[model samples]
Target: MSNRSHEVEYEQMLLSRHGLWQHKGGRGKDGPMERSAYILLSRIRVQGPMSIGELSDAFGLDASTLNRQTAAAMRSGLVERIPDPAGGMARKFQITDMGARMLDEKRDYFVQALDKVMADWSDDDIAHFASYLRRFNSDIERIEGRPWPRPGTDGP
Candidate 1:
């Protein structure tokens, strides 16, 4: 198939996946936590505490939108605002212990769901697919100049 055809197919797949995430309770239980919360928590977990402005730049979201999302997270006790370790005027948000636990649980559930869906695939096939997906995401992040921190690494 041509590159254009592949791009179209990938776009459709992403749209379908997004729809599933939105309509299905992908986060588990009654889905009390919003997807944005999960994403923000995950980012903080990996990158350590970050200011509203930093998160805004990282996610390409407006400060007002992030303010609302972070406010909700704080209300739920998933995150807390603390003085920036770097001694900045604006405080940074850090994931709480509870947030870390919840994020871990949600991650495990997501992995299990993927396993069920890919049950027919061999281990090698799954590994290759995962590698490709990672590469694809990395390329997009690089192009957008917003690469996420590598897992287990402190972000810049």
Candidate 2:
């Protein structure tokens, strides 16, 4: 591996060891959504309804995997399948009202947790860190050809 690759690998390993991404279930109205559900709902929330094919293209995942994830989300009342508004043959998934509320709650919880973790960091430092993260993610997305949508812009 190159020098930068080695450094990135070490940092990523340390981040994993920190256990910050571990699921903290059992909270909110539905006991907190799963990570997959949270991400899938977030995409739908931002981009409106999306068919399975669209999701597969966006996430670079196969239909079977998306099927399972969407099924679980539907069972959890987080998303529902509706006919494509554009008259397409395949149905699209849309976030439900409950899903929206739960997404908001879950997002708030995550923001609060991050704020607590960064309590000692200065505002400028945090901003710089955020900028770096966005750049990093955007570069990866560019390489993968699967850019994500973001608020206040056409896409992330």
Candidate 3:
């Protein structure tokens, strides 16, 4: 198939997966957290506390939208706002212990679901697929000029 055709197929698959994840209780909650909430909590956990402006840039979202989202998270006790640890003027959001526990649970659930889906695949095949997926995400981040902090690396 042509590269363009393959890209279209890939996009379709991604949309399908997203739909399933969002609507099918794939996050292990009958009413899963909003996608934005999950991503925001996950990012804060991985990259440490971050300001709304910084998150806006990273997620390509407006500060006001993030403000509302963070407010909701705060109300839920999933995150807390504090002075920037780096001594910046703007406050940053940090995930709470409850948030971390929830994130870990959701991650485990997702992994279990993936294991079931890929049960027939060999270890080498799984590793290769993971490598390519990471590369794809990295390339997109590079193009967007907002690279995500990779785990186990000293990130800027």
Candidate 4:
């Protein structure tokens, strides 16, 4: 079968540019959290607390980058550093109550926006689209060997 690599690449770029992650509908004075902050907090929420080393491995990011991100998060009171629950040497970053609240608000806003956008789509079509996107993301995660933790599943 022929590959539609170019088509997929262009469409993916467009989607990224127009995606919910970039939406500007935050409900508070501070506006939405930065993309990095959102993703980091989301990961922590899904997978529990994470140390710097674990975050680095999970995201394939460097220590310096994670340090900056986590530091910013701490300053904003979105996360806190605590002794590892497992009694490990490195401290873990845990999302704060405020962080969870903000994340939930942002997520709810995004869902509302998506609902409006997909108002005309059938339930079956939405399910199919979600399935395809999950498959695509799973394939990417498999290739990278860095599976993400899903809410209802063991992993990925």
Candidate 5:
């Protein structure tokens, strides 16, 4: 949890300081399109409705940059501006139902990719790995003031 340990982990995983950017999941994408899309969708899916400012903070980006990206998402009907769950003047941006469906599709794609990559492993191996991974992630979340990503979560 210290700066030194965090940097080491980032160096090992090729992750940025925020843990959103990683090299492992960057394969087979047109530029960073797939990565950007996946990360954006992941935040929206995990955090639920959020303001443009909140998204900017979560992704460590500028407002104008998200404005452009979210404009495209809005045009595609994948993202929508909605009443802020927090109830503020700023509108909360949320993934539409269509967006959620697309997220599910991408989730399946990632799951399939993971399955193929881990195909040699036995069922017990898969289950064991999954359990430990969950525990590791839960500990990280406890440190970060965030909840583990999953359905029915209160936050991302």
Candidate 6:
């Protein structure tokens, strides 16, 4: 087996073993907010005040699907939709202060949950894994599209 093929297979196996597919239920087969909502919030955090159409395009989802999730978020006061300041077509959605606060709280919960869940792991090991996992995510985004999660960093 070639080195590149082996590496690809290893990564695939690792992802399959631990990705959303391996959870008790299939992705979005179980979540209340729907995975679409999560992606919307994440993109909103990164991109800021994007129109629904743009979000739909970025995630390869349809406007209806995106609108459904955005509607739910709006009802919950997690997002706010406003007229596009520049005026053109689609209205823009922005995360509210409440939404940002919720994201931060969720992060803290994740940290605590992982710490308790991995109580036996050494601090150094955990830190290393966290850093590498973050880098891996960043690299995958670059591979899939371009330098994102840090816009415009991809060199010439």
**19-66 per-residue lDDT for model 4 (tens digits):** 666556544455558878889999999999899999999998999999
Q: Rank the candidates by lDDT, best first.
A: 4, 2, 1, 3, 5, 6
At residue 79, candidate 2 shows an lDDT of: 96
Model 1: per-residue Cα lDDT over 33-119, one tens digit each:
778999999888889999999999999999999999999999888999999898889999999887887788777767776888899
Better of 2 and 6 by lDDT: 2
- Each prediction's Cα lDDT score? 0.84, 0.87, 0.82, 0.87, 0.71, 0.68
CA error at residue 18 for candidate 5, angstroms = 22
Candidate 3: tens digits of C-alpha lDDT, residues 1-156? 999979968986885775535544444442356667888998888799999999999898999999999998888778899999989899999998877877777777678778988999999999998998889889889999988887787763
How badly does each model clash, as a count of residue pairs?
0, 0, 0, 0, 0, 0
Q: After superposition, how far is residue 61 of candidate 1 from its true place, in Å?
A: 0.6
Q: Model 4: what TM-score? A: 0.92
The TM-score ranking, best first, is 4, 2, 3, 1, 5, 6
Off by over 4 Å in 6: 1-35, 86-88, 146-156
TM-score of each model, in listed order: 0.84, 0.91, 0.86, 0.92, 0.64, 0.63
Instruction: Give the number of the best model, judged by TM-score.
Output: 4
The superposed Cα distance between candidate 3 and the true structure at residue 128, in angstroms, equals: 0.5
Worst 10 residues of 5 by lDDT: 24-33
As a whole number from 0 to 100, the lDDT of residue 139 in candidate 4 is 93
Please give the lDDT score for candidate 5: 0.71
Candidate 2 worst ten-residue window by lDDT: 18-27
- lDDT tens digits, residue span 1-156, model 5: 899888867775762343333444443332233556667878888767778898777766799998988887777667898787776899987888777776666677667767986899999999998897778778876776555456676665
Model 2, residue 155: distance off in Å is 3.2
Clashing pairs in 2: none
